[model samples]
Target: MRIATTAEDHRIAVLAALAIAIHVLETALPSPIPGIKPGLANVITVLVLLQFGWHTAAWVTALRILAGSLVIGSFLSPTFLLSAAGAGLSLAMLGLAWRLRLGLTAIGLSIVAALSHMLGQFLLAWWLFIPHPALFKLLPVLLTFAMIFGVLSGTIAAMIHRRLTIGTHQT
Candidate 1:
């Protein structure tokens, strides 16, 4: 049976556009380190997860990563592989966090996913490209960036979620 377009489809399209835009923009910016990025696109992921569901967030992330790489010409390259792995791992952790449903809010889940994403990318990079002990040396710097950006993204996600919830209630 053919699936019909619904409000959820519209939401995914809009969210995907927002995420891909952020991803492409971020790719254009210069970073101090090779793999260190703020992952501002994560804000959309968190918003979708909290507002819609994990499946919605997954669609957004997959489309963002794939389309962002194609737009930036990183498709099927090591960069794409690393990005895909990190996103996969982060999404896994997000699903787990949501299922657990502890007191952990978006901030907590974002931090968890951010750290996992960083570690996943690092490990994949080491195995697929570096294959040297020195690869581990970058862990500290990457993790530091991850923690900082994680908090920032989470805080932004939280604020956005709050506004969305309030707006819905007021409607």
Candidate 2:
């Protein structure tokens, strides 16, 4: 019925709004790791990808980064590069996973995404500002943390997706 469709549409919108909010809040939180974040917004994206498709998730993730940067006043700053890199890498991973039929349970996918994200940002930084190769000295450390955080975030997202599916089916 039209009513059911409308309600479902509204729920999708609400999920997207929540995704945006999570993006903003996560960005605002200070982390000891310079560019590290839980990327809580990504939870919604992964869920959306599993439920909807890669296209929808990609759009939501892109919007979150753009709007989040504007909200945090880091739109044109060096920090923005990191966020941009992460988004780009995340999107790529999502696409690959979808295409490869990689089950959401694969934590390695998240780790790869995270490593790519860190590399992207570092490459951007090196190209944009730091021309010296010596700057890469910190990469090993950052990469380690990236791997750990990526696994953590991925697990959380997967868990949330499982719960949402259960909730949807129960209702």
Candidate 3:
């Protein structure tokens, strides 16, 4: 029997594809520090969250992580684990913010996700890989990068959202 797919499914798929493309492309960019690349793909996630809802954003993000990892050849690896943990925590924070009606804009939400994502990955890496107090020193730097990238992605998302909204109203 054939399964039926709704419009929402298609929407999620398209968004996931976009996010995956961005994720894969991001891998090529050299980072000043390991694991310190700007998460431009998350711009799509923030846009999805604002335009659709947190549920759709979550679906898109999960698919992006899975497929992006597979494409990047990091599936089921330590990197993947760290990535998953970060994404899971980020999603949870977004959901909480959404449910709590915190009235956060794309920028605020992105900052929250970025900080949570960094913390989750750092904690996991410390517990699983390094297990040294010196690792804690890196937290401040990582968090600073997260905050910078978060603002950048959030600004991009907001601009895209505004253009889309204006386009919809125009036509």
Number of the predicted model whose lDDT against the real structure is largest? 3
Model 2 RMSD, rounded to 1 decimal: 3.9
- Mind sharing the TM-score for model 2? 0.82
Residue 57 of model 3, lDDT score: 96
Ranking by lDDT: 3, 1, 2
Off by over 4 Å in 2: 1-13, 104-106
TM-scores vs. true structure, each candidate = 0.94, 0.82, 0.97
Give residue 63's error in model 1 in angstroms: 0.7
Whole-model lDDT, candidate 2? 0.75
Put the candidates in TM-score order, highest first.
3, 1, 2
Error of 2 at 5 (Å): 13
Best by TM-score: 3
lDDT of 1 by residue, 10-102 (tens): 988889999999999998889988888899999999889998889999999999989899999999999999999999999999998888886
Off by over 4 Å in 3: none
Question: Which lDDT tens digits does candidate 3 get at residues 69-167?
Answer: 999999999999999999999999999999999999889989998999999899899999999999999899999999999999988988988899999
Give a tens-digit lDDT track for model 2, residues 36-129.
Answer: 6766676677667777787777767777777777887889788887778867977887688789986655355566667777888888888888
**Candidate with the larger lDDT of 1 and 3:** 3
Q: Return whichever of 1 and 2 wins on TM-score.
A: 1
